[model samples]
Target: MPPSDLDLLLRLRLVVARVGESDNANWWASDGVLSPTGQYAYDRIAPRTGPFARARVAFAVAQERCASQVPPGALTLWTLPADTEEAFDDRWSHWLDHVEDWAPTFAAVEAINTSSILTALVEHGLIDGQHADAARALTAAPPDPSVRLAETAHIDVDAVRQLAAGFACSQPAALVVPYVRSNA
Candidate 1:
């Protein structure tokens, strides 16, 4: 039997998480400088070359193969556009040039946020109702102050809430409007 859409999504999540963990560990070890040893290590495992590359390519193939079976909005929640591959490569190159300044770009963060994926899966009856409620609750919460700081240290609480609202509004899938924090 073919793998279910849920299985594909779970595999994709695991793959993406592994990539993130590897990137984080490498960043900490090299301090984003990529010295000779670091360069060698990266060359062996970078997204374009070795295990990571193979895993990504396999996952992409699986995703494409299973696309027709996935429910509407499910694929969109988990998959990025084809052009994002080039953009991701560009971002990695930029990171190499700007050592010690590594951080997830806004688009990267948004794309990786799993709330929408979880919600969509639940709506499609792929995940349990309990998870659906949890996903909705998570998306409904106000943006973390630290997230705002990452984007701009000068943004106030109100501005953060406004931005979050705007972001939620822009998404094609249903996203709950974040409630205003009481202290704000």
Candidate 2:
């Protein structure tokens, strides 16, 4: 394929999973809602609260990073601290707007790297794949949290190597490139 075509094929995907604060302690009491047999009570997640439940609540709270791209690019999924529902919508919207502003265009992939986006996504709850190619594809399989970093990031390798000496990732090399941990 022509270089222009390859650049045109770039894809930008963002899948973020932010940890939110919880107030529904009794959510599992089965009193909120129950199944047909009443044996299993829904965990009452953001997805569970669809129109049938009540409303669309913000999910994956923390900081949305980028996921993947079609032609193997990068994405930016901005995640924010999801605490209360009072101003959730506003915060979510603002953060999303920010990400949108910083989002990379396929046309600019050559100028700006896409690895950082994928790393951010992985830091959040975007796609989690084993291979570098898969990671750049927005695969649904999210990788483990608290990884050293990605070589794609073009970060200091020795820093990650040092971190790996202490806190290493759980996933095998089959999933992704081994990241070394850093003391910092």
Deviation of model 2 at 91, angstroms: 12
lDDT of 1 by residue, 1-184 (tens): 1223323333333322222222332101212122223334555766333323333443454334324433333312224333433444445444355433322221232233232444333333344555334333443233321111022323232222232222222122222222222221
Q: Candidate 2 regions off by >4 Å? A: 1-131, 134-145, 150-184
Q: Candidate 1: which stretches are off by over 4 Å? A: 1-48, 71-78, 82-85, 92-184
Candidate whose lDDT is highest? 1
| CA error at residue 20 for candidate 1, angstroms | 16
How would you encode candidate 2's per-residue C-alpha lDDT over 22-122 as one tens digit per residue?
Answer: 21111112221222121122223323222112112212221221111111122112211122122334443443444343233311221222224344334
Worst 10 residues of 2 by lDDT: 12-21
Which residue pairs come into collision in candidate 1?
none
TM-score per candidate, chains pooled: 0.25, 0.18
